[model samples]
Target: MKFVKDGASDIGMKLHPFTLRFVDDQAYLEEEYRSYYFSESISSIRITLVLAIFFYAVFAGLDVAVAKQYQTQLWLIRFAFVIPVLVLLLILSYRPWFRKNVQALVGIGMYLTGFGIILMIFYISKIGLYTYYAGLMLIFLIGYTFIRLRIVSATIAGWSIVLTYEIVALCFAHTPTIALINNNFFFVSANVIGMLICYFLDRTNRRDFFMRKLLEVERNKVKAANDVLEQKVQERTQQLLETNVELKKEIELRKQYEQERTKLEAQLMQLQKMETIGTLAGGIAHDFNNILTPILGYTEMALEEVEEDNTLRFDIEQINHAAVRAKDLVQ
Candidate 1:
């Protein structure tokens, strides 16, 4: 009989908090998850960095073409700040050390990107604020798409950007109340939405990881059971082979015994025949001796009665001698 537990605990289910502060409970899965996350994020980081460079180049060119007053500052921001940070991220993505410190690297790269955008916003005129906001959205999207940060790291990076923006908007931009409220609402909403997406994405990936582990465990179990069953079958087959060999030996021995028994029976029959012949010969000799004894006795009486006649006496003696010889032969 198989015993199956019928509860969530039996299935290894645990209640996890939705807050970003809560760490994943599956400690055994950490290395495997890290490897997977690293491979995926590395490729994405390279692609996103390349795209960022291209887009920034295009924006810088457009600014030059339009003869914007802060074109030099824009170029400096793109080349010095943005390009260097992206290059650093690309370099780190290839390095083994980055895999060991993935969360930290991601958080640092995100902060650099956000800080670059904030610097651009500060330097660029108010009219170009919309363009910088668009750039910020792109950075946010890239964070969601490429970086794939853990819950704590993502929360830290995301809120830090938001706080930095709020402070910059208040102190530097010095915008009107209604516009500040609108910008805050929009940026906050965007951050919230991005956080939700990252949360769900991380959750989904982890769930799949757990599921794969479970399937692997089940497969191993089945393989072990099959191995045991195969071993038993082999053992049983070996036993049967041994039994068959023993049976063949026993059959050969039985046949040898039968041949010996037949030979012994033939010898016994020959002995019995010899015994019967000997008994018959002894009985005939006994009967012949009885007849010879009577004959000799009669011959002796006749010789005594014919004693006066010499010729008759000689004939009687001859008869007695012949009878006596016959009696000796019978004995």
Candidate 2:
């Protein structure tokens, strides 16, 4: 339902006169629309019932008063006709299934109520009680105020009542010429005014329905957007969580590599230290071997110079043994 751009008001937008029509492009006769109308009618049941009962009582009392002064039989007939229609309205009001046909029911009820009133008016005129003709206004008032109906239904019902009354009064009631003219004028004026009011009432209701549908559409759109946004947020959150897990694993792997590198560096340093010690020991062993070689050469020379059985030769032999032991140690 597209709203015309106009000044904003309590109803959300200005309701142009062109918008007032019996046919609504935005759902008016659809199921949801009918349901809305049905609910509204159901809600008004109590009020309509009370009004019916109150009017029935008033008219019954009037019937009694007029009957005492006029024909009792005709008043009885009017009472019987009106009382049954009111009872039917009350019964139908409480029937949950009857709401679907609410417009038809109300139209029928209104027509019957008008018919009863017309009958009473006929009797009143027959008894020369012209003053009671003013009561016809009650029918129009009741149609407008108590019963909620579509413009077409109301118009049909309203005109039917007037037409029936005119025909019955003109044909059967034998109303005088001046009185007939007056009744015609009154009924016509009342129906026209009632129809106008019914038209606007229906238009206003349709506009309100249009606004509600528009709001529902907007709300659904917003909900869909929010759902999409929430889904995206969840997906992004999941992706970030997965990325965080990967980063943690990478950090742990890097830490493991660093530990392995540190251990390797410590082992490499120990290997390097062992290599340096081996080189130093080899240099010291070469120096010691050179010293032992000199000692052994001196001892051998001493042995050659001295005799085999001499004391000096024995001392040279002990020194040669010591030199040989030192050479073995150097090797």
By lDDT, the best candidate is: 2
Across residues 122-175, which tens digit of lDDT does each residue of candidate 1 receive? 765366443466667777777765667876687788788878888887898766
Q: Candidate 2: TM-score?
A: 0.75
Flag clash pairs in model 1.
Answer: none
Kindly list the per-residue Cα lDDT of model 2 for residues 1-331, writing each as its tens digit.
Answer: 3332234222343333443432433223355666776776666755775677577666667666765665465456455776677777778777887877777888888788777777777777777766565666787777765678777777788889888877877898888889889878988898888888877887777767767866876787799899999999999999999999999999999999999999999999999999999889889988988887878899899888888888888877888898788778767
lDDT for 2 in candidate 1 is 19
lDDT, candidate 2, equals 0.74
